[model samples]
Target: MRTWRLVRVVTLLLLAVSYCEFFHYYMVLLLCTWPSVSSVQGFQSHPLRAMFIGDTHILGSNAHWFDKLRREWMMTRSFQASMLIHSPDVVFVLGDLMDYGTESSSTEFEYHVQRFKRMFSTPFTTRTEIIVGNHDIGFHHMINDKRYERFKEAFSAPSVRLISVKDVIFVMVNSMALHGDGCSFCKEAEDALKNIKWQLKCSKGKLDQEKVAEICEKLDIMNYSRPILLQHFPLYRTSDSNCSTPDAAPLEEIDIPFRIKTDCLSKESTDLLFELLNPRLVVSAHTHHGCYRLHDNGIPEYTVASYNWRNKHNPTFFLAELTDQDFIINRCSLPDEHTVFTLYAIFAILLVIVIIIPPKKQKPNLGKSFTPSNKDH
Candidate 1:
């Protein structure tokens, strides 16, 4: 009987340890319920619930097996739980889809894609949009036709394009091409942006349809709204010195001056985007930290933190309730890595103690048994 009791106790303890190790993700989701969105008067009855994930940086050749498995599991659990709980209308993955993306061969890239798909699989109704990051292809100096072609083939990533959800328009750009250097890649990106500008102008009744007959036939330009600019790099900024957000870049990096076209888009590139797109808001991710900057023109730009635990202990993403005229963005953090691991460690310790310690033996039926025997005699 003691043996059976010990077996059951050990089994339950093991299950407890397992829950702390894996199933704790769901608990985090239950605890961090999606932020409530304020209803705007002019907005539709239901605003678009858009989920924005920051740089995932899924590892490639550099990852150890255990590290790769652990990170992927965490991401998969968080993503799955978020989808199940939030039921977002759209998911925007804000670049850096893979670490060493530029270094991966075709086969390696395919494997990475498969892994990403497995972790981030969504329902058919939930649309996903991905932006191009420097890591996915390369920095301006390292970008080439071959690398660009591979990424484009895998993701269908155009240099710049426009996406419309409900009445909201999102102008997604390949920020890496905003180097301002007139390379072949840059020229193509520049041309695409110019085309988007013309389209926007046409939508606002500033351009004659007769002059651009080709583009006019492609869509009902009059129906489009002012765009929300989406890109991989933040606009020109000196540094994060002025950012006061809790998730802003580390204190050590706060005062470090940013390099134009390295840490952020060049001044000229930023100006061109603002002049052309006339965006209502801007969203970017690359620094793996959160930042909120109100540009000089009064436009708000939000830099989302990384979604992968490998990047930080407290990974985070954005939840934006969007409309044609207004938006509400809430920064939601994933389960803390340290907390999750600590919980698992504690449970594991309890499990080890349970297995090591013997179950207490029943202390004496001594007097009772003797009395029964004497009465029978």
Candidate 2:
């Protein structure tokens, strides 16, 4: 009888253990999976407003804190929805949509896609454009692989496309080649640019002295106003190697891979490219640090902070409100501890189920024996 009681206890304990495991697994999956919605509202009018968000690095397999950060992001759906409610004509995501290229999968990537879809949905169907970032290109390892192919396949279409919006001719440049493992695409890009330049001239467009000038000339001929260049890397001095500022310490600056480099259009090749492009406003994000500056030539370049674990302190986004005459730039900081606490509370509940519930279930079956004592009396 005692043996049977022991077996019963063991069975209950096993069931409790199984239940805990299943619950934890399901919660984790829920945390990682893409969110779904019934419907997306459309914008009511045309020529609406627009905003720019950059570097949302939403991938990691590390500590619970990472999941907490992700949950915080998940909660921002309402915040983003409010922006759409204000009727932004378009939304520009600068770069670094995902943290690791190697970690890209159908399921994982879909999670990111769904997140963006939820945040950027509109009533009148606002357009959302995404530019390729360094992480999107696989950093240093194999360049232009399945992940890249998948990204292009997913976002290269007309819906989530690359095109000029209104007066701002947005050019989504793939800047990963500068730090990619090979030089194949780098050469190919250079060749493509040369061909594009020729095509512009053939179309009766005069070439400018600088690369920016040529690009602007071509865009101008196409009826595009001042071009706003969007790339993954900053065009200005991101490092203090050339200039000095009290706030410009090496540690204080964003430390990207050593393979990648940045300069303010004076590094010969890159300088020529920027000078020719002569973009009115250049927006980029890769260093995960945020900065906004105006060059001597009156061009403004802004770097957006990342929405990832690395940039927890400044987990914010840039909002560019464009009018007919000019645009206003605003930095909106994401929600901090309130959202984080909700996630922690969820994990804490799971921890209790996993560690406490099973042991309590196995505590001897004393109630069963006591019930039968009535017959003996």
Q: Which model scores highest in lDDT?
A: 1
| Backbone clash tally (model 1) | 0
- Residue runs of model 2 more than 4 Å from their true location after superposition: 1-48, 60-75, 105-124, 157-162, 179-182, 192-221, 236-259, 262-269, 323-325, 338-377
- Per-model TM-score versus the true fold: 0.90, 0.60
* lDDT by residue for model 1 (1-377), tens: 56866786778777876676557777777665445455455537777889998789999877898998888888988999889888899999888999889999889989998888888999988999888899999999999898888888777888888878887899899988988879998999899888888787777765565766766557557456779999999999998888887788788888899888988998899999999889989999888889999999999999999988899888888888887777888888788989977876777787677777767777766564333455554
TM-score, candidate 2, is: 0.60
List lDDT for all candidates, in order.
0.84, 0.53
Error of 2 at 309 (Å): 5.9
Clashes of 2: 16
* Backbone N/Cα/C clashes per model: 0, 16
Residue by residue across 142-164, what tens digits does model 2's lDDT show?
A: 55456766777777721112245
